[model samples]
Target: MEKKELVMNCTLALHGCRTSYDRSDLDSWYLLGTYEYDGSKLYLNTLDDKICYCDRYDATPLKSWDSLSAMLTSEIERIFGLFDADGHCIDEDVPTTPVVI
Candidate 1:
């Protein structure tokens, strides 16, 4: 018989609901929950199958958990080329257009 080994990664929480990540292949995981603070939202994912979801808008609200993590992932994808509420750009900073007086 052969045995398989499991690998686990950890993420650290940042100020407010944000987090500091040290992930290499971020595409492998799925979102599990979210926390709202100020005007920003933080989505959390787990390496394990267990989830800690808490919200009324969940698709399977009463089911406690579901595989619909792809939904949040998709939302993150949709905003890939935009700026946050703050003035930070999605990509690296670029020179702004100057105004002519």
Candidate 2:
């Protein structure tokens, strides 16, 4: 649950919500958090675990849903590693300890 002071003033249209599937129940959806994406400005919102939200953020109308989704997809692609023609991830090595990139 989110703290009262960190209440999210974000809307679903402009903010992308990240969800998770419980290890025990794959069919169920649980919210992880919200991401406020404004083009180059993307930040983890202070939203609590819920599937829906109001249409306004801080008394301002949120951006289109398309913008939020597009940003989320782009960010995921950048973070997720690429795969090879053989259908395996290009980088297969596992790190035993922390190493700075």
Which candidate number would show the highest TM-score if scored against the true structure? Answer: 2
Worst ten in a row by lDDT for model 1: 2-11
TM-score of each: 0.21, 0.23
lDDT of 2 by residue, 1-101 (tens): 33211222221123344354334433232232343332122232223222221121331223222343554454344323333443334554632111113
Model 2's alpha-carbon lDDT is 0.31
Q: Model 1, residue 26: displacement in angstroms? A: 26
lDDT value, residue 63 of candidate 1: 23
Residue-by-residue lDDT tens digits, candidate 1, 1-101: 11111100111122332255655545433444333311222233345433333332443222222334643343344333233444344454421111112
Q: Rate the local accuracy (lDDT) of all candidates.
A: 0.31, 0.31
For model 2 the local lDDT of residue 15 reads 36
Q: How well does model 1 score by local distance difference test? A: 0.31
